[model samples]
Target: MRVRLDYGKVGLEVEFPDHNTKAVLGLKPTVPLENPTKAIAHALRQPIATPALADIARGRRDACIVLCDITRPVPNRLLLPPILETLHRSGIPKERVTLLIATGTHRPNWGDELEALVGGDIAGSYRVVNHDSKSLSAHRFMGTSPNGVPIWIDKVYTDADLRITVGLIEPHFMAGFSGGRKLIMPGVAAFYTIQRWHCPRFLEHPLATNGSVRGNPVHEEALAIAKCVRPDFIVDVILDEANRTTGVFAGDLEQAWLTGVEFAGKHVRAAITEPVDIVVTTCAGYPLDLTFYQTVKGMVGALPAVKQGGTIIIASECAEGVGSPDFAQALWETSDLEAFVRYISQPDVFVPEEWQVEELAKVVRHAEVICVAGGISAEKLTNCFVTPAESVEEGLRMALAKHGESASIYVIPRGPYVIPTLC
Candidate 1:
């Protein structure tokens, strides 16, 4: 049988599989909705529109750094050119600009990855670098957080004449959003600040609280400290489901974060309305090693809304394997999370992963993690993390049954990535 087919409405057409197939409609995920680069350019160009890129370029600024979030979905590649171009237009030579990875507590970005971000040419011209948690000199304890906990920061932040930061505003495990305080707190804070924020498990008051460092108080305090150093500009971005920039916020750091948060709210946020028993998710292959560290994002983001001991189904495709070998070996050796934290006595003075490991320990204690991936060994995956049935469907059904078939559920196909879960 032959049939006339038309998908004029969707601008697509395809042959059917059956003798007589039903007319179907579909949408393409890769379809370019709008050019994000142009959108980001427009947004940044809008706010203040004061210090034109050219204005800053002609200046006598000595050094500049471009700090961008490596979390999945942010269109750093798209956002980079216009801003860098602006810098070039302003007269700040490419040689003077340094591109630094703002991984903070997240795993560092490699050289090739850095190039893919800022572009091959820019990546080549400027020195691309990563944050070194191991360097004591890199970190300096300037003062205590507003509540008095000591706040140590990266010294490089002090050296730059023009400092610009990039990040997406999304749901966080503790904070309402992931930008603002994020750029400085874990993004560039020394090991000490990172340890205090993560070790005590202070999600109750996730930073930017009315006041107090005991709360995830690092964000606000960090922001205050950044102001002391005075970042010439900040380019806070908002991403869509594809992680491309839906908006770019320029000017003041807090204001840019607020703008990105509002814009991101439309895409990254899903209100539970009622807590779910089973939340199937993944670590969107980022600081989570595209797979190795990815599971953490799911655990953190889903922790608040998921019922205690509720099952969390995770899917990570970490091709490089889970965590660094040193980290992996350390975890197997120590079942004691606190011991891990206790042994690393001077975090402001010691290893960053030791602090991160402690936080990972806390999450493991609280949740039932079920992983789904192909790159890693099932035995190792099962031993260290929970490797569920081979597929998302199998895992979803199992998770649903564990929570009772009637229990509400959420399926995060993209897995665990950053972007706070705002209420």
Candidate 2:
């Protein structure tokens, strides 16, 4: 068996003897700076109840829902407990609290993955449920966004005393950075709302689009959307390469995310003063899920990291084909991004999230995305997005050898979902 390990700025490859070429990625877990729970609680000391929690308690905000990105890496174990405790101490009862998994259109986390997050013991105590776009029973139509886009929020938001969310703050290519308002935009916003907000090239500004890596417009818009919901307090975490709780931000999302950006700048941030011609990244393995709807984030996320015509080697082990049954059909059927957006965006299109299906398909237009894994078929790769290679080395070498030192490749070894630029 052959194994490949990507150490940021370094490469480690090892070969093992095995009849089957089974390879599990290598990860060296880092001892959390302090237990995540402890760090979360400590980080909250400065913010939380200061004006932030007070406003939430005043009913100025109607609800309190703790949100975490469903697919990305979040210090849930460390993040969630503190919020519940803080809310509890702040006089917010458990019943008044709702835990929303901001899944966007991604499949709800089930079985072990879900269990592992909240801890087996803590999981049972709360009414922890997932976001279900297809479940009319779980959705409530909020009037519309400032953009005049219709929004369907969870009934919990409309009924609760205050709204709160928990998530990680990281550089996201499309949104600039994650956390803050993002906890709500794609976090809790209805499928239609998300489609509209995502449709606009919201991050066209220099800080958002230019080589400037910070102060992004995409992050601003996502925050604006979150502010629209008026969350009383937000507990945002900053994780390290090992996904451990490196730091925490609790208070106004904008303020907290400003801090998050500062933290992210220190860790995963790379000083790419110049635009790179090629980027090779893994999907981080989750968001792509069984299909491309989740996988497209990688393409969009990688948008900022590469040069205009650079190729992005997207190594995704898509175990399942295009995820949702409806999405898969649309992907295989669409020829290109333009046709995809046109067909799905049509007013007559009945599918609720048709544009999203189209957006995932649109990835084919931006850059050459190469996938490597046993998940989806190779045919799906070449026919739909870019092309697929047999292994990571093959893909990396393909891009590297092509560009040479001039190529300036950013290899996010643990990707398929992680926006290579952000990590």
Candidate 3:
């Protein structure tokens, strides 16, 4: 059987002998929006649990629109113009509106990428700024949540008379689901705030796993943090396997996003009756897999379907290399897997990107993980307690050799977007 996995800008295809392949997990059949621009406009006009955007922006002077940075597949080009028009129609001048990229701890998005993030026309016409979490001078402390997460957000986001955020709703490894409240917490929050929420304590919580929220502290905290800003509106989209917009949820951040989350659960959750001997997956595709730091999501997603002590082969096109120098340094700090866990388990350890190490540990504890990619060096992969393979085919061959010829294999082409549930 020929299995095609989503890779980089293009795609990767691998042929597996039909005998070993048990299943190919992917998104359930869902219709893509014929005209996403029209759908977005309609959602804005008839919003959930709030007034239409035009009515909300009627008398507001300054407005700040928050957008996810390079990592997300948010279709800003299709979503932004109609929003700008609504602001303009409500008498808010374009000059008073600022487009802020909620970069969190990631590097600033700029130049050509910035243009593509929010169309060239929008970039040229509007004032766009990148959030620098390290800029202590640019943030305002709004006290702390009941759960003790510090609430520090960018002044640009808080000072605006009207605040709007654009994001894509999907299954997130840590937060249960992405978009909505997430665009506020780790999106425009300070480095200190982000570190507090992502601490080892939250990482070890059972409710912190994917496809949940009611009792999940991570989701609850994110919602509380977003309330600090009291954003006026939100525009979150649901995309299919092909990255085409399939649904739009707009209006109140809470209600609209909850609606989207329900919609996402149906399409993303894949039920499996038994565990597989070998699980092969990808980190969605380009932009998502551009860096190894982001590739941890794929490993976590494959966990439910792979048996303990089984093998997991993840292929990513991490063209940007390991992506986080601090994460790489953290790997080098520990001599072995147990030591690495101890280093991250400390409550006071404030290493940047340390959360990645914590999440990677969860997967490593369950099964043997082999990373298949050329961008990350084998030496670096070894230090991180992951074996390295040059190709998915090679990784499969090695895993099958160890597990025997009858080893069952499951493939996840879209990675984190598809949640595997043991039936």
Candidate 4:
């Protein structure tokens, strides 16, 4: 059987032996909205829980809208126009509105990248700024969470009279689902705040995995931080495999996001009767697979579908290479996955971007991981403790030889976008 896995700009197609292939998992098909522009307008006018967006914007003088960074495939072009029009109609001028990119600890998007993020027309006309988590002065201390996480948010967002966030709702590896409160916490949060939130205390929690919210420490703390900011509204959307908006959720930050999560969960999740010996996956392609740091999600997402001693072959373009300087350094320094886990588990030791490595540790402990990332040299990937493969076919050949020709195999074309759970 030939399967086209999501990889880089164009997909990678590989042929697998029919006798060994168990199943090829993917998100259940959902129809895209025939008229997304009309849907966006309707969502703003008849929002969930809260009053219409126009009504909410009536008395507010200034508004700050938060957007996910380029890594996430949010439909900013479609979601922003109607929202800006409503805010303008309700008396707020273009000058008073700010579009803040919620970059978190990730680098800022600028120039042509920024234009592509929000569109040339809006980028030229509007006051768009990138969140600088590194600049402590840029953040205002919003007090601390019950769990003792410092709540420092970008003043650009908190200073505005009205706060709103626009995000894409998908199954997040740590926080149950993305969007809503997430656009505030790690989105615009300070580096220190993000460090604490991503520490093993929360990320190590059992409920912190994908498709869970209740009792998830990561989700709980993020919600607490967002509550301090008190965002007046939110616009979250659910997308199909093609990245087309399938559902538009706008209104009360929590309510609308929860509604979208419920709707998204049904489609993004797939169930398997048993675990497989060899699993092949990707980081969902393009912007998401640009760095190995982001590609960790694909590894962790495939964990549930593979046997404990099985092999996982992940294909990510890593077009920009491994990741941030800190992440790359950490990956290079780590000689032993067990030792790395032990060191990071200590309360006093917290390295920047180690959470991703820590998550990778979970996969390493369970199964052998072979990476098919062309951007990174074989030496670098080997130093990071992952077996590097020249191609997915080569990786599969090695795995099949180790597990025998009859090994059950599962392929996840969209990778982390589709959660495969055991029944």
Model 4: CA > 4 A from native:
none
Which segments of model 1 are wrong by more than 4 Å?
A: 1-35, 48-58, 69-73, 105-107, 139-141, 149-152, 201-218, 285-289, 325-330, 336-366, 385-388, 394-408, 416-423
- What does the lDDT come to for candidate 4? 0.92
TM-score of 4: 0.99
For all candidates in order, the CA lDDT equals 0.57, 0.59, 0.89, 0.92
**Root-mean-square deviation of each candidate, in angstroms?**
7.7, 6.1, 1.1, 0.9
Best by TM-score: 4
- For model 2, the superposed segments whose C-alpha errors exceed 4 Å read 1-32, 52-63, 90-96, 135-142, 200-221, 273-278, 286-291, 301-310, 342-366, 396-410, 414-423
What local lDDT score does residue 144 receive in model 4, on the 0 to 100 scale? 89
Q: Write the per-residue lDDT of candidate 1 for residues 175-276, one digit (tens) a residue.
A: 456666667666777766665665443433335221122344435555665555556667766554445545667766666666656665555544444445
**1-423: candidate 2 lDDT, tens digit per residue:** 444533222333534224312223222233457566666666666684446454356443234565664456676765677667766776767765667778776677776867776677557777777876555456577566565656666666545667777777765546656777777777766676666665534433445531233466555556556665667678787665556676777877677767766666545534344446666555555533435555565565566567776777665656566567666666566666576565545553544456455444444455666766556667876656667788766776676566663456554445422333323
Tens digit of per-residue lDDT, candidate 3, span 52-100: 9999999998899999998998999899999999999999999999999
- How many backbone collisions does model 1 have? 22
Ranked candidates (TM-score, high to low): 4, 3, 2, 1
CA RMSD (A), model 1 = 7.7
